[model samples]
Target: MDAAPIIVHRPRGTGGRRVTVRGQIIGLAHSDRDLIEFLRQSGLDETTAEEMVGSNSAMIEWRGGRPHDYAAA
Candidate 1:
């Protein structure tokens, strides 16, 4: 299957992280759970979604902040 890479951008003023793929915004996540749900909705299963959000998976590019960090700095 072909899919655009995921990018989790820096947290915004509302402490929500913008999730995108191929420069298209997909959704905003306030926590890891929200991120996982987005991944799941994008075709990943539960375990895979959790792993992708927890680990530094190459499929996802985390920008401006580390994983699990949702508070704007």
Candidate 2:
């Protein structure tokens, strides 16, 4: 069976929101630049980081209590 989708809603003007999936923070970016930095900090390749910036949302997979993997959702 497939797992349920993770949804993160960050309200405007709140300095961004913390996105936690399965008790882990998978989404930490609030803007395009922030996303780029986040992705780069997460060890994602340049291509993947660029691709992620174009996406409206993302799906992340956790492993060992950390962001082990992710894909544009």
Candidate 3:
């Protein structure tokens, strides 16, 4: 992933002016998901993968999707 980070925003505007915007960065729990997978393929088990991956909540909240949905898919 790009270490520089990302931005999300909502903008409101009229012919006269603009207003009401919000933004946030989407980031990994640690180095990135690829790094986690690398460790796992190298023999790290699921338990350690969970630890290294940190949190999935970031994606869940950003996507407004439940954590279980990814697994089901």
Candidate 4:
């Protein structure tokens, strides 16, 4: 069976930044290495980037344009 798509909405006005690969967002994040590199470039330094991206499930929610909640999926 195919998997349902998981929606991770990017809040509006995020400096118009979006992750796209081969002209699409889907399948862009195809591996942990890519995610870690993205997090680092997104400003999370090496340690934090590694930790966050290494996890299986990481959910970050924001309120007032800042990270207000985080939890595992």
Candidate 5:
């Protein structure tokens, strides 16, 4: 796996996945759009954030679930 800086952690029991950038929690994301917004809030432009999440960029590490998988477990 790539040593990515952005991490979308496992889905929680209630819902959503915790998102972290450089080890700092950004927010919980239930969808790609939410993830993009969190990235934007972290100083990334909307277009860039969208692209990053959409393309499944190597900068992000998806754990315990595939991208877009946010159902409670």
Candidate 6:
């Protein structure tokens, strides 16, 4: 089976943030609303967005950092 698309949050320089799905850069998201909008713009439904945001399957990365899997949290 294909792996589920991973939602990633990364810290951008100048204190901004960006979101990506399946390695494709979506858009900047500094808050939940912005993240939702980015996900929607990336063609994800509301349900999928919620799942991705709340799921332990998501990933997060900081500037000059390695990916941190939420599943470990």
| Position 55, candidate 1: lDDT | 77
Better of 3 and 5 by TM-score: 5
lDDT of each: 0.85, 0.47, 0.32, 0.39, 0.92, 0.55
**TM-score of every model versus the real structure:** 0.84, 0.45, 0.27, 0.39, 0.93, 0.54
The deviation in Å at residue 27 for candidate 3 is 19
Model 4 C-alpha lDDT per residue in residues 1-73, reported as the tens digit of each score: 4321222223344221233322334322323555556556656698885765455333322223323112221
Give candidate 1's total backbone clashes.
0
Q: Pick by TM-score: which candidate is best?
A: 5
Candidate 3 per-residue lDDT, tens place, 1-73, comes to 4221211112213111111112332222222354345445546686775564466423222222332222211
Residue by residue across 1-73, what tens digits does model 2's lDDT show? 5542333334324444444444556665455555555556667787786675565335532322223223222
Give per-residue CA lDDT, model 5, range 20-66, as digits (tens).
Answer: 99999999998888999999999999999999998989998999976
Q: Select the stronger candidate by lDDT from 2 and 5.
A: 5
RMSD in angstroms, all models? 3.2, 9.3, 13.7, 13.6, 1.4, 6.2
| Model 2: ten consecutive residues of lowest lDDT | 63-72
Clashing pairs in 4: none
lDDT ranking, high to low: 5, 1, 6, 2, 4, 3
Query: If the candidates were sorted by their TM-score against the true structure, best first, what order would they fall in?
Result: 5, 1, 6, 2, 4, 3
Question: Which ten residues in a row are the worst by lDDT in model 4?
Answer: 61-70
Ten-residue stretch with the least lDDT total in model 1: 1-10
Which digits, one per residue and each the tens of the lDDT, describe model 6 over residues 1-73? 6544644545555544656567787776566566666776778797776666655443433333333221211
| Decoy 1 TM-score against native | 0.84
Q: After best superposition, candidate 3 residue 72: deviation in angstroms?
A: 32
